[model samples]
Target: MALLSHDAGGKPVRAASGANATLYCNESTAGLSMLHKELAQLDERVQRLIAAYRQARLERKRALQERDRLLALNAELKRRIEGVVERIRLLESDQAQ
Candidate 1:
């Protein structure tokens, strides 16, 4: 049978037989160490994901800015072409007259 009691911290503590207690303690410690390692790995993965998200957002913003600049350049080119066409039309009319 096991002894059950509350420690000073109000947490229930278990008292076990000597050999069994030793085996259980070792296993618990190993399990806790494994849990800590797994948590550390998860933390690393989360950090990497956050970094990737930030990089993607920055790339998207840069692409948007590039698109806007290209659009403005296209509009400017169109306006210049229209002005040239108007000048050519006027010159052709003067020649015809």
Candidate 2:
């Protein structure tokens, strides 16, 4: 399914036979360059994660503020309902008398 070759270091290099693609390996500095490339990729990934974390924190803060406002609104509605119920009870007692 694939082609395999070796460099001076005898490292197995895999390539796609259909695409006629090969890995050009320079035994002198392939490992060092690959290491640097991997490090760069890792740094980019870490930066993306940090940005996502900051965005999540901002969204969570906004959600908590909305929840607090809703709770305050709920308390106010409950107070108004209690006042109405008390007036109804007073009217009932007066009718009975």
Candidate 3:
């Protein structure tokens, strides 16, 4: 007897060609059910990975904005310090005279 049967969809049909046809059908059904469960698990994992990628991209953008703000603040502080130094030098020269 043939150990396997084919359905119209080409998936293994749950039947045997001979006396043990019932047992074959049960086994085939169980296998297909397990395959469906595994596929569901894989799908959930893929969705979680996609969510994590989006979160990482958002964090990177925030970091870049913070870096730009700090750079602007540093430039402003440097300009103020240079102005103060020039004033101190002028004051010292006037007192010396």
User: TM-score order of candidates, best first?
Assistant: 1, 3, 2
**What would the per-residue lDDT of candidate 1 be over residues 25-93, giving only the tens digit for each residue?**
777679779989999999999999999999999999999999999999999999999999999999999
| Worst lDDT 10-window in candidate 3 | 12-21
Provide the global lDDT of candidate 2 against the true structure. Answer: 0.80
Candidate with better lDDT, 1 vs 2: 1
Candidate 3 deviant stretches above 4 angstroms: 1-14
* CA-RMSD of model 2: 9.1
Which pairs in model 3 have colliding backbones? none
Predict model 3's lDDT versus the native.
Answer: 0.86
Q: Which of the numbered candidates is closest to the native, going by highest lDDT?
A: 1
Candidate 1 accuracy as TM-score: 0.83
Q: Provide backbone clash counts, one per model.
A: 0, 0, 0
User: Which sections of candidate 1 miss by over 4 Å?
Assistant: 1-15
lDDT of 2 by residue, 22-58 (tens): 3333432577688799999999999999999999999
lDDT of 3 by residue, 8-65 (tens): 6988645546657867777877987897999999999999999999999999999999
Model 1: lDDT equals 0.88
Candidate 2: residue 73 Cα off by (Å): 0.6
Instruction: Quote model 2's TM-score.
Output: 0.68
